[model samples]
Target: MPLPPTVADLTSFDLLLSVARLGSVGRAAAAHGISQPAASSRLRQLERRLALTLLDRSPRGSTLTETGALIADWARAAVEAADALGAGISALRASRHSRLTVAASQTVAEYLLPAWLVALHAGNPGLSVTLRALNSADVADRVLSGEADVGFVEGPAVPSGLDSAVVGADRLTVIVAPGHPWSRRRRGITAAELAATPLVSREAGSGTRGALEAALGSAPAAVLELSSTTAIKHAVAAGNAPGVVSSLAIVAELAAGTLVAVPAADVPLQRRLHAVWPTGAQPAGPARDLLSIARRR
Candidate 1:
């Protein structure tokens, strides 16, 4: 059944219950943190909507009439139910505030999340955080399945059925062992040539592979499909094959001369990193805080 407009405002009903208990509109208004005139006006509006004379108002005080007392009795149950609902909502919010589950792609997990998590914990010392490092596709799956409160993904496009914001950007690097023939090349490699050549690569479903495929406009020929940037780096450094990975992951190797960056002039190697959650459901509590830290950096 549709609620009548007058009975729709729970606060007004709550005010009536207060007036019934306190025996004075002025006293009830004080309890509600409103002035006497405001309280009286609300009661008058309620009475007009219900078409009942609820209060016997006197110069000395106010008292509920028979109809008013009956209505108050019914409203009491509803008020109690509303209180329970408020309590349940508070409990859920507190739980979320104190605990967070996050799923992130390898690049974000390895190179980015440490700083973000540090800042998140700094602000929320009591918060318990769990982090899962997976490929981009798996991160999306975890978020969609409600296994994670929020997810970070590195890909050219966000997965369907998730809402996202670009928290950061990264560029893919093609690296080779110092002895590889590509290391000594004077000019940048074109996308077609890079695609035609077999390279060490991250496995399918990883953001690094997805971005490489998107940039080349076709899947690059892979000599081996390893799962981690570390594995790809080790393979490339051992002269197995050239590998494509995040520039963020290769800083130390590049500086140490173990790996050399091979420029891809025609490929769009840059990709955005996203923070994602279930569609239409905005992140709150600790999840929101972590997202803020990611974007700020």
Candidate 2:
């Protein structure tokens, strides 16, 4: 008779690897939808069973020790093999009904996803989609936790445990009320000049805010932190302060002359829009189909 696998053998080694990669026990627990203490105890149990330490823990973060690094490499190989088998099985079972849930940052949700959704629906009438609009960080979190089938964000980098591909491009444009000083200037605005002026901005965690911070070297003089792009545009138009926003979001305002798009010497600030999904979870069925539509658009 074959010997039974031990408790350690039954524990998911994949979880351990993911925790190492993400660098925080809390984040890892959230990704798996378990309590932090449970995750910690499991890791300890695994360590005790293996007679090896896998992580160096400090308040700063966790890092894989030497033995952990070696084990992690092997674990990754096993995960790849398992994923391949799972993919083959999933492909075989593709005829079954499956739902796709997608979460997108506010700008993409407001401006881009509706068109993509219409196209996706035309192509796959049988597929159901649930769409949620959130900030970029929340979109990534939902994808990593399996709560969202896919995510679309505009930002600097993909959060750990989620893979992202740039599906489109967008630009951040500085705008002012038609009467503002910069509206008539038309050119010669440097980064320093923009920095010195009081700016209306989105609150922290917004993808637009992240892009602006990256371009401007620090947080702007946020005279007002509004939640919605529409609200920000209204504030700018009321002459509250100059604001930066996605070019797509302010299209109607620009066209109607309610707001003026200021020209900066080197500053049609461009940013890449990304489509993201969990690193190990391949897009399938409706999710795969939607991704294709988004990419083409």
Q: Per-residue CA lDDT of candidate 1, range 1-297, in tens?
A: 997786778898899999988878999999999999999999999998899999998888889999999999999998999999999999988987899999999999999999999999999999999999999999999999999999999988999999999999999998999998888887968888899989998888999999999888888788899989899999999975888999999999999999999988878899999999999999988999999999999
- Top TM-score hit: 1
Best lDDT goes to which candidate? 1
lDDT of each: 0.92, 0.83
> What's the CA error at residue 141 for candidate 1, in Å?
3.0
Q: In candidate 2, what are the lDDT values of residues 108-224, reduced to their tens digit?
A: 999999999999888778777899988888898888888888999987667788887788999989999888888888564788888788889888788888888888777778899
Tell how far residue 226 is off in model 1, in angstroms. 2.3
Give the CA lDDT, 0 to 100, for residue 228 in model 1: 90
Compute the lDDT of residue 282 as modeled in candidate 1: 98
Indicate the worst ten consecutive residues by lDDT in candidate 2: 3-12
How does model 1 fare in lDDT? 0.92
